[model samples]
Target: MTPVLYLDFDGVLHPADVRVTASEPKRPRVYNGGSTNHPLLEHAPLLERILAPFADVKIVLSTSWVRVLGYEYTMQQLPAALRERVVGTIWQGELLQHPPRTRYDAIQSDANNRGVTRWLALDDDTEGWPDEQRYALIAPNNFWYGLAQPGVADELSQALALLCAGKPLESRLPQETHVPSTVERIFGLG
Candidate 1:
């Protein structure tokens, strides 16, 4: 079975709160408050670097960008290396006519249709993902950091290694650690 990675653009490659102007629908801009002002796909190089050694791994677009911007336009946004790895997209033709409820559902349906037994998803949306299949999801929960978040690249690399090795993906996402406000920190209450 060919190893597949379901890639999300909004929250995986860049910040989740991205906006595209009516005049420039193809150009996506990030609006993640004032936390982190990362350019679109600012972490693309990191992702590209991680996947460089795994030449056989294929990518499947599971992002809403493909639905909103069209497949070709969305594909153009990726760097050459990542773009070349894209085998297909989840939002096209029949799937577009009848879209899935959640990202996980779309990927699951696509994987089953393609007979892909070894696959994982790099996404931030965890709404409909079940606990049993959580092992296949590498979630960069912080919208501001996305793939740049600490340990996310490592998690993705490790997952890809496991997938290529034909090993069961059993790693769960690390528990979130809370960062206290400055006030709490100063008062030693955190």
Candidate 2:
């Protein structure tokens, strides 16, 4: 089965925001949806419930959540089992230094790592991408420009349905995809 490349957390797994308080300097902040009333965390028991149908599928957490919230902090919030299913993650930290090019590069890298020829990305940002090709431009319920989340959402069934039928981008743009042979280095595939 092909992997489902999930990117948006608010639409695919959680409510988009949760309050988290920390001491020291005394700060109250919001998390990237996963617990309490948040979509994915609220329905933690439903991860398998939702994924059992796609047992052959694999998941790639291509979110900036790891960078913002930190890897350990996010994984600890998972409901044990789902935490194990994740093959890996791609944090768009430095990518943020760039713009649309960064987003495009990260997606391509994630796809390559998973050996994904076909996948879908549930993101609110479709800045430089085309709608006719790969990845879904699914907008989340309450998506923030720079925040990140780590699961599927409750209200994105239609988008997910489209993702189920999604295809990969075949863009000829130099910035959209990077085939190894096209790289300047010659150590291996490049």
Candidate 3:
């Protein structure tokens, strides 16, 4: 089975908090209170580099951007290399149901429907995820750095390597504990 990667755009591809003005909807601005000087999709090349050797891996969109920006427009934002790997999305165009499902639930349902046993989710919303399945989640610090967070790229590469090898994901790498600096605390990036 080809390894599947559920990709979240806001946090995983770029900074989490992106704002767009009606005058310039095409160009979104990221404000982290000057904590980091990274551009939109600044970490995309890193992701592209990591996935370069794993040619069989497929990507599934799991970001809310699809709902807000539309699927085609959202896909267009990705670099050509990453965009080509996109196979589908988690949003099935269903009407909003009462008591919205969490990211884990959506990913689980999508995986099950597709019979995908080898899959991982790179997301920031660390809510409603069961303890046992935590290994499948690569959550970046969305409030601040997102994928640009130190050690995140390495962890992602390691996880992808393990996944492509058909190894059990339970042996996931340990996450480095991050203590926010004074500036980060002031900006609420911690």
Per lDDT, the best of the predicted structures is 1
Give the Å error, residue 32, model 1: 3.1
Clashes of each: 0, 13, 0
lDDT string for model 2 (139-171, tens) is 443444212233334323433444455533333
For candidate 2, give the lDDT: 0.51
Kindly give the stretch of ten consecutive residues in candidate 2 with the minimal lDDT sum.
146-155
Q: Give the TM-score of each candidate.
A: 0.86, 0.54, 0.81
Stronger candidate by lDDT (1 vs 2): 1
Tens-place lDDT per residue, model 1, 12-41, is 788799887888777678875633456888
How do the residues 66-151 of candidate 3 rate in per-residue lDDT, one tens digit apiece?
76667788899899999999998887645223224798988888898889999999999889999889999999974567787888
Better of 1 and 3 by lDDT: 1
RMSD in order of candidates? 8.0, 12.8, 9.8
How far does residue 93 in candidate 2 sit from its true spot (Å)?
A: 9.9
